[model samples]
Each structure stands twice: as C-alpha cells, then as structure tokens.
Target chain A: MSRSVKKDTLLKVAESLFYEHGFRGVGLKQIINEANVATMTLYNHFSSKENLIEEVLKQREERYWSYLDAHVEMESDSPFILAAEAHGRFLKEESYKGCMFLRAIEDYGEMDNNIEKIARGHKQKLLEYFQQLAHRKGKNNEKDLANQFTLLLEGTTSMTPLIGAEKATEYSIAMARTLVQHTS
Target chain B: MSRSVKKDTLLKVAESLFYEHGFRGVGLKQIINEANVATMTLYNHFSSKENLIEEVLKQREERYWSYLDAHVEMESDSPFILAAEAHGRFLKEESYKGCMFLRAIEDYGEMDNNIEKIARGHKQKLLEYFQQLAHRKGKNNEKDLANQFTLLLEGTTSMTPLIGAEKATEYSIAMARTLVQHTS
Candidate 1:
C-alpha cells in the first residue's frame, strides 16, 4: 500500500479501537498489529503514539461534523429542531460510539494538554453551532437558550450508554422543545 | 498496623490513583506500592482488583453522601436548592474528582456489569432525591421537574472539568430555578 493509504488504514483501525477501548486501554502494539502495518511503518507515519492520538482526534472531529452534516439540511426546517433531530439520529446509529471528545476529556484531561485542548475545542464549536441556531430562530435571549439546549445535549450524551441512546435522545429532544417554547 | 488499617490505606491510595488516572490506567502493583502494603496483605483484604474496585466505589458512595449531607440541611431550606448548592460546593472543592460514579460508568460500562450497576444506581438514587424534593416543593408535575433538574445536575457534573465547576454549577442552578418555577 502507498504511504497515504497505510496512514488512512492506521487512522481508521486505531479510531475504532480507541472508541471501543479508551486511549489508555489500547497500546501502540495493538494498533500496529490491528492495522496490519509494520512497527517501522507506524513510526515513520507518526512520530509517536501521542501524535497518532492527536491525528485520530482531528479525524474524529471531521467525522463527527460530516455525520452531522449528512443529517442536517439547513434549508428545510427550523435550525433548532433540525440540529436536535440530527443528533438524536446520530445517537442511534450502529457505529455510534459515545462522544469521542467527551471520552478524550475523561481519558486524558489531567495528563495531556493537547488532548484536552482538542476535546474542549470540539465542545466549544458545538456550542457555537447551537448558538447560531438559537440566534437564527430569534429567541429573545439566544445565548441563554443555546446554553440550556447545549446542557440537555451534553446530558443526553453522557447518560446514553447507561440509559440507552434512544431513550436519552427522546428525553433530550423533549427537553429541548420545552426550552425552545419557553424562550421563543 | 492492624489489618483494617492496612486495608483502609490501600483503598485510599488506590482511590486517588484511579481518580487521577483511570481504572485501566492503574494496576494492582502500583496500588500496593503506593499504599506500602504487602502483596499478601492486599490479597487478604480483597480477592481481586475488581473486588477492590467495587469496594472503592462503595466507599466513594458513602464519602460522597457524607460530604453532601454536611452541606445540606433538609429543614433549613428547599431541599432542591440545598442539594444543588451542596453539589455545587462539592464540585468546587479541591478534592473534587469529577463524579466517581460517572467516571466508573465511562471506564467500565462495557466490560463490567458491576461497575455499570453501581454507577447507574448512584444516578438513580440522586434522581429519587430530586423527585422527593420536587414533591416537597409542590410542583404540579413533580416528576418532570425532578427529571429536568437531574439532567441539569448530570450535565453540570459531566461538563465541570471542561467548563470549570463554578460556571457549570452556576448554569445548572439557574436552569434548576427555571424548571422549578415553571412546574410549581
């Protein structure tokens, strides 16, 4: 395989493993073996496991937004419900591992600055998207409504694995509707 | 030292390490080394690392309730606000290690049934407390109010390390107030 194809294979395999088991749970050897790439090839592509993790995170961010983009059609409906519906659908997908950013924060927040930055950045960007939706909807206080909706979204994400994703998303969608009604 | 004292020391040391790193991040050897206890002594107290982890979680549950009890006087004010305030205070404390239960769920939710049970039980109990308080406050839809408040509380817990506990708590408290007023 070419260098770029090998690198993509590494990212794809490692991302699956990292999502299934946490960052600390999976090691470089496991990733290399699973990716079917030689150890030297792995090292040549990424300087270190940490660098590979950062790349995985960057790729995950792209994947997540891409997933959201496919589900959300901006021209069709209210941005608020459209965004909520998109997330609710995303939560139920077969490949839906829980929020990778939240997992990253939980796994590496205390130990790794770069991981924490990337994870926090993902959350901030999502919050900004919600703020944009809230503003477009013309809520009296867009920021406050955005904050509440974001909390509901975060709560649903954190609770899904325990309560099951569909139920959690249902509750979150209902709560979001209530908040939108109250504020709008 | 007495056997019980040795066991307590192991739990304390292990708990700290588990909280800083994750369940998979720390190992039995590290726990024994950090606690300065013999391998035999550690095994005598707990059959395996899994058992030790369960005990640590049980002890953590007790410690968390005790900490909350210290701050919340059921008769002094609205139990809802008081409990939320107690949690907000706990979140700001130096030893605040994110919700141990939440961390446990995130860590072992897939592989370990016992861990998921304990974590889910903790959340259920907190929700019941919120329900009882909502009943006391005479909300028309006490259960719904309780659920909303619980979501805010859970969201605050999950987001604290990223957003800073104080800000997270402030948002939760404000949202809780809004929910309470709406339902009352």
Candidate 2:
C-alpha cells in the first residue's frame, strides 16, 4: 500500500480502538496489530501516542462537522430545528459512545495540556457553531440560546449510550423545540 | 484504625483517586497506598477491584441523594428547582469530574457486566427521582417533564467540567425553570 493509505489505515484502527476502550486502555501495539502495519510504519506516521490521539481527535471533529453540514444540505427546517435534528441523527447513526472529546479530556486533562487543549477547543468550536446557528435563526439572546442548545446536545450525547439513542434523540429534539418556542 | 474506620478510609481514598483518574487509570496498589491500608485489607473488605468500584459508586449515589435531601429541607423552592439547585450545588462543591457512573459504564461496559448493570441502575434511579419530583410539582406530563429534567441535569453535569461549574449550574437551573414553566 502507499504511505498515505497505510497512514489512513492506522488512523482508522486507532480511532476505533480508542473509542471502544479509551486512550489509556488501548496501546500502540494493539493499534499496529489491528492495522496490520509494522511498528516502524506506525512510528513514521505519528511521532508519539499522544500525537496519534491528537490527530484522531482532529479527524473526528472534521467528520462531525461534515455530518452536520450534510444534514443542512438535505433539510430545510429552521436553523434551530435543523441543527437539533442533525445532531440527533448523528447520535443515532454513530456508535452512540459518549462524546469523544469529553472522554479525551477526562483521560488526559491533567496529564497532557496539549490533549486537553484540543479536546476543549473542539467543544468550544461546537458551542460557537451553535451560536452561529442561533444567529441564523434570528433568535433574541442568541448566545444564551446557543448555550442551552449546546447543553441539550451534550446531554443527548451523554445519555445516548445508556438510554437508547432513538429515545435520547427524540427527547432532545422535543426539548429543543420547547426551549426555542418559549424563548421566541 | 477500627475495621469500619479502615474501610471508610479505603473507600474515601479509592473514590478520590478513581474520580481524578478513571478506573483503568488508577490501580488498586495506588488506592491501598493512598489509604495506608494493606493489599490484604482491601481484598478482605471488598473482595476485588470491581467490588471496590461498585461500593464507591453506591456511596457516591447516597451522598448525592443526601445533598438533594439537605437542600429540600433548607429551601422552599418547587421540587423541580430544588432538585436542579441541589444537583448544581453538588457539582460545584464536589471536585467536579464528569459523572462517575457514566464514566464507569464507559470504562467497564464492554468488559464487566456487573459494573455496567450498576451504572445503568444508578442512572435509571436518577430518572425515577426526577419523575417523582415532577409528579410532586403537578406537571401535566410528568414523565416527559422528568425526562427533560434528567437531560438538563446530565447536560449540566457534562458541561460543568468544561465550562466553570458556576456558569453550567446557572444555565441548567434557568433552563430547568423554563422547562418546568412550559410543561406546567
């Protein structure tokens, strides 16, 4: 395989293992063995385990944004409803683990400043994305609305694995509608 | 120390270490070392690391309920607000790691059936607690209201570690008030 393909394969395996078992639980050897790559290949692609985790987080964030963007392209609901449904759909379709970013912070927040920074930055960006959506909806007190929206989304993500994803999604969207209508 | 005192010390030290570092991240050796107890003492009291974790979760749940009960006794707010404020205060006063039960589920869900069961049971009980609070408040749709209340609380818990606990708590209570008023 080409070097790029090898790198992608490594990332795919690493992300899957890390998500299932967490950053600390899964090791570099397991990632390499799963990817069917040599130890040298893993080292060549990422400098350290921390670097690999950082790359995985960055890739995951991009994929999340893409999921939201794809939903916007297909749905014509109001921005608030559209965002909520998009997020809900993402939760249902994904494997329904808790938020990977938050998990990353939980694992590495104290030990690694860089990892925590990336995790916090990802969440902050999501909050800002909600702010933009609320702005597009022309809601009064858009910042406050965005914060509530973020909370609901975070709640939905956290609750999905325990409660079924479908129920969690339904309740989240229903609450989002109530919050939006009450504010309006 | 007395047997009970030794047990309490072990539980306290174990809880703190597990909260700061996850279950997999912190080892039994570290727990015993911190508690100044022997390995045999830990095993004698709890049988295994998993049992130790289960006891810690049970104690934490009791502490959480006591916090809410204390608040209800001291304040005259509606049940919904009382529960929300109590939870908010719990997050603020505690060191504010992510939800320990959910974290347990994440770490041990795949590997340990009993751990996952205990975690899920704890969450279900919290949901029921919310339902009782909603019923007391005479909400028209108490079940749905309770679900929303649980989501907001979960959201607040997840967000508290990222945003300051104060802001997360304030937003949660405000949103809880809106949810209660709307449902009523």
Top candidate (DockQ): 2
> Can you write out model 2's per-residue Cα lDDT over A51-154, one digit (the tens) per residue?
99999988888888887887764224467677777888878776577888888888787785677899999888888877777777676677787787888888
Model 2 misplacement above 4 A = A1-3, A73-77, A138-140, B1-3, B73-77, B137-140
Which TM-score does chain B of candidate 2 obtain? 0.91
Work out the TM-score per prediction.
Answer: 0.81, 0.91
Q: What tens digits encode model 2's per-residue C-alpha lDDT throughout B58-152? A: 88989998988888642254777878888889898874777988888887877856888888898898888777766666556767777777888
Query: Which window of ten consecutive residues has the lowest lDDT sum in model 2 chain B?
Result: B72-81
Q: Which run of 10 residues does model 1 chain B get worst, by summed lDDT?
A: B94-103
lDDT, model 2, position B117: 85
Angstrom error of the Cα, residue B132, model 2: value is 2.8
Per-prediction DockQ scores? 0.41, 0.72
Instruction: List clashing residue pairs in candidate 2.
Output: none
When summed lDDT is taken over every stretch of 10 residues in candidate 1 chain A, the lowest stretch is A90-99
RMSD, candidate 1, Å: 3.7
- The window of 10 residues in a row where model 2 chain A has the poorest summed lDDT is A72-81
Residue A47 lDDT (model 2):
92
